[model samples]
Target: MLDGSDLKSVRKNAGISQTDMANKLNCDRRTIINYEQGVCEPKSSQLFRWLDVC
Candidate 1:
C-alpha cells in the first residue's frame, strides 16, 4: 500500500509538482496536499488515475 511518504518520493523522483498532479487527477492542489500530508487517502479510482498519469 502506498503511503504519504512513498507518494511524495514518487512524485519528487518523477519531477511532478503538486499542482500538476492535481491537474492530472482532476482535483485541486489542496487535495494533493491532503494526500501527502496524510489528512486523507485518495479514492481507489483517484489512486489508479494518479498512478496512470504520474
Candidate 2:
C-alpha cells in the first residue's frame, strides 16, 4: 500500500485530476478519492500506473 501523503503529492506534482487519474487507471473517481483520503489502498496494478503517471 502507498502512503496517502505521497499519493496526494504525486497527483499534485503530475497536475492530474482525481477523475483523470481514475480514467487513466481504469478505475472509478471514488477510488482515487478513497486513496487520497486514505480511506483505502490501491491495488498493485493501480499502484504501478499511478507511479507511471506521477
Candidate 3:
C-alpha cells in the first residue's frame, strides 16, 4: 500500500495541487486530501493512476 505522507510528498514534488491530482485521477479533491491526510486509502487502480500522474 502507498503511504499517505509519501503520496503527499510525491504530489508536492510533482508540483501539482490536490485539485490537479483529483482531475488527473478522476476523483474528488477531497479524496486527495483524505489520502494525504491518512484519513483513507486509495485503491490499487487509483495508485496506478497517481503514479501515471506523477
Best by TM-score: 3
* TM-score (all chains, Cα) for each model: 0.88, 0.88, 0.91
Candidate 2, residues 1-54, lDDT tens digits: the string is: 568878989998989998899899998999898998889898878888899998
Residues 1-54, model 3: lDDT tens digits: 657999999989999999999999988999999999889999989988898889
Rate residue 12 of model 1 by lDDT: 80
RMSD of 3: 1.0
Worst window of 10 by summed lDDT in candidate 1: 1-10
Ranked candidates (TM-score, high to low): 3, 1, 2
> Pairing residues by index, what is the TM-score of model 1?
0.88
lDDT of 1 at 36: 88
Model 3 TM-score? 0.91
What's the residue-level lDDT of 15 in candidate 1?
93
After superposition, which runs of candidate 1 have C-alpha atoms over 4 Å from their true positions?
Answer: none
TM-score of decoy 2: 0.88
Clash count per candidate: 0, 0, 0
Sort the predicted structures by lDDT, highest score first: 3, 2, 1
Local distance difference test, per candidate? 0.86, 0.88, 0.91
The better candidate by TM-score, 1 or 3, is 3
